[model samples]
Target: MTSSLQRAAFAGTYDDESLCGSGLMVVRAEAEAVAALAGRIDAYFAAACKLILACNGRVVVTGMGKSGHIGGKIAATLASTGTPAFFVHPGEASHGDFGMITAQDVVLALSNSGETPEILAILHLIKRLDVPLISMTGNPKSTLARQSQVHIDTSVREEACPLGLAPTSSTTATLAMGDALSVALLEARGFTREDFAFAHPGGSLGRRLLTRIQDIMHTGPEIPSVPETALVRDAVLEMTAKKLGMTAVVDGRYRVLGIFTDGDLRRLFEKAGDIHTTPINEVMTRFCTRVSPELLAAESVRIMEEKRISALLVVDDDNRLIGALNMHDLLRAGVV
Candidate 1:
């Protein structure tokens, strides 16, 4: 019974367009709200930052429902970025998690309405413990905000949800503000990638930045190398024995001068004369890629990829061949 135009309008306008429009509107409105409030940081925000910075223990973030979800994420961001923080459920706080909070700890409480009954119940206990309280609420004059040592306004003009009822824009604004705070504190404290590696030592970045080159390269017997004056036959034997697809050609002192690979063998095989009698120096590539022992194995992998090579010679400051790595080595080490 519906006209095609009506169906098209409904499909194109309210269905497909609505999603992006509403999401963008929510983010734009939230960004504006945060920018407006940034000018109002005043004494309250300063007090909150000061209290948190002075605390000897962790920041205990707590809230109920959607606010609780945001609080947990904020706590994680803060902790990963150099601030010691964790989230406690408001319901659980009243049960036993309240004991987790110490006098030296700071409380970062969230409640959009500033009237989460469970959080309100813990205000007195928090005060009694002399722990500084930082409240994030929409209502500045509400019980939780008024009772706190510092308050951040997370008020939203309206919900981005058309029904005017969901915690869409409000929660987004709170999360953005939380991220801003955590990143600011992280930069102020000079938190580095190495510091982050300690907390996330199982992930890709932890493995890449935290792992040393010595842990992954092929050394000792597995290293493929030949003396500079060695016959091409002997160098090919070393490469085949080590199974690295290439062999480092070094002088008597073990100073690496070049490398010989399968590519060189293929090129030499077509020669009109005796190739086995040829010296490795005659067929070796003099300007081959090399890396230092102290360099990251991941970086060495990148060099190999960029140079379109299958193997790299690891050398010391004096260019002495000490190790070697190939694509297979990188794959096995998880550095690829």
Candidate 2:
């Protein structure tokens, strides 16, 4: 019931000594090309890195067709990793997007053939605008390379496509080269995890990497708390008022002396005793786990999970109570 085209497509992916071997061969060749470029990461690489690092504006990357798509991706990678960058289609550059480029910016152009017409037509304009040019191309002697202030040779041995026309290995090499440039810039600038967090503030990684305990901890009146001399009823009231299912028992200076939780309440209610007059000191968990405000919220999550507790009291170095946080707080902060 299979059609000829579908059968042919499926058959290309079968067997060990077939076109699949050729496919892997092409990939291996491209990987070798990228590895060879590692030795060329010298003055030209340094100059390109310096150009982008010294940029007071942004990195405007441009290309045409498949190269343009790769350029867009490279621009995004650079931007997310602390180097400010964006992409402009070369075809669109003639349609007025070129206004986005400024004298303070650097232009990173990409082309596999190194002779993309739309890209070449703008070489003089880039020079006139005084924007430094860095090109990634397969041919070192191509027009883009000759016109570039810095040329990164990303040549490939062959196309993975059997037709030898569709870009495959060449694009992979170009992307890897872009990654090399981005990581080099990231290190030379001494960009930190905190800096990366700012760029990715909306994701789970952002929450874990950027947020501190103080930023998400429950404090002030929201912290469920009771005095050491307080009765069980009072502890219950504090827990209810804060809706955190627990309360920290403090001494005169608000130092965390013990903690009473809903589970403790359950145990008390189930015991053969009158709850009305029992002091929380008799029923509170004195050996409660505590954390510091400077600790990462993710670390708190680990501690809470390890101890099997739903809440924790945050204290200062002096053991004085500072704040409180619960599983709900972690969930709300997106740390969970």
Candidate 3:
């Protein structure tokens, strides 16, 4: 049977006030459930984490129905952080997938009522393997909670569901507890940003931490360059040809002397100098900033922002120009 709120929604009798009131009720209920979890993070929670940390193999999380979905996300968060973990459906675990859990692994079982049939079905197998069992349940006195080596209390005062049949608040509490476990384990292991990058190599944070200037900088023939003796016109021609908005001024030995850019061209224009006659080195900015190929693209971003510059030149040990890059390059590489 639906609640009055549900009936009103179905009958199109709900106004904005009623709709918002019902939505707020759900939000408040879920919020209270999650808030209660803070106090529940007691000794039992620590014990669960200890079991996971001491495990030699992996964390095998299993649950039935809605709990299974939360288990999958929890497992993912655990695996991505520091602890290796994966989700297994309780129904599937009884069907030979139980072989996946060895004595070296720890099993984390989820069941709000603490008496899910599928979860209980795997208890004998889990016991046979002598694996550590950690359970999260709303009932501390329930069978699953009693059988587990460690039991975390995820009980909610009320479900957000109007009829109290849906998983609403229970699932949120379980997911929050899962996050707490994952992050606690992560901190205990002293997981670093570099370690996280290895797990998420394709993510923006990974790209920022792992990408070197050489990986995104214009290299070889793509580098815009001109000899110091080259006229302003020649430098402008090279810049336009390379489309980098600037050209490196180098000596005959290819060692960088300075840089000529669009800004310098504008200054030259104000002074009424003949672009074809004036040498680039005479009008270029001397002692221009340079970066090494091994520098991180993220570091280059800091340098650019601090110096209020839009472009940078990449140089080798001998100060020879090897590459060039602008802010646009960093943006394209997602370093920005």
Evaluated against the true structure, the overall lDDT of model 1 is: 0.86
Runs of candidate 2 exceeding 4 Å displacement: 1-26, 237-243, 251-255, 262-273, 287-294, 302-308, 315-322
Better of 1 and 3 by lDDT: 3
Query: In candidate 3, what are the lDDT values of residues 1-336, reduced to their tens digit?
Result: 899988887886468998899999999999999998989888988999888888899999999999999999999999999799999999988788888888999999999999999999889999988999999999999999999999999999989999999999999999999999999999999999999988988999999999999999999999999987789999989999999889999989999999988999999999999998998878999979999999999999999999988999999999999999999999999989
Clashing pairs in 2: none
Tens digit per residue, CA lDDT, model 1, 1-336: 999988887776567687788778877866776666676567766677778778899999998999999999999999998999999998998898899999989999999999999999999999999999998998898999999888988888776767778887778878877887788778778899989888788877777787666778889888998888899899878988999999999888989999999999988887853557898888889999888878887787778778999888889999998888888877876667
TM-score on alpha carbons, each prediction = 0.84, 0.85, 0.94
Which window of 10 residues has the lowest lDDT sum in candidate 3?
Answer: 5-14
Instruction: Show how many residue pairs clash in every candidate, following the order shown.
Output: 0, 0, 0
List the global CA lDDT of all models: 0.86, 0.90, 0.94
lDDT of 2 by residue, 1-336 (tens): 999999899876666787568868777767776777777788888889999999999999998999999999999999999999999999889888888999999999999989999998888889999899999999999999999999988887777677889898889888988999999999998989888889999989889987789999888878888898899989988898999889999999999899999899999878865567999999999999989888989999999889999999999998998899899999989988
User: Which has the better lDDT: candidate 1, or candidate 2?
Assistant: 2
Q: Rank the candidates by lDDT, best first.
A: 3, 2, 1
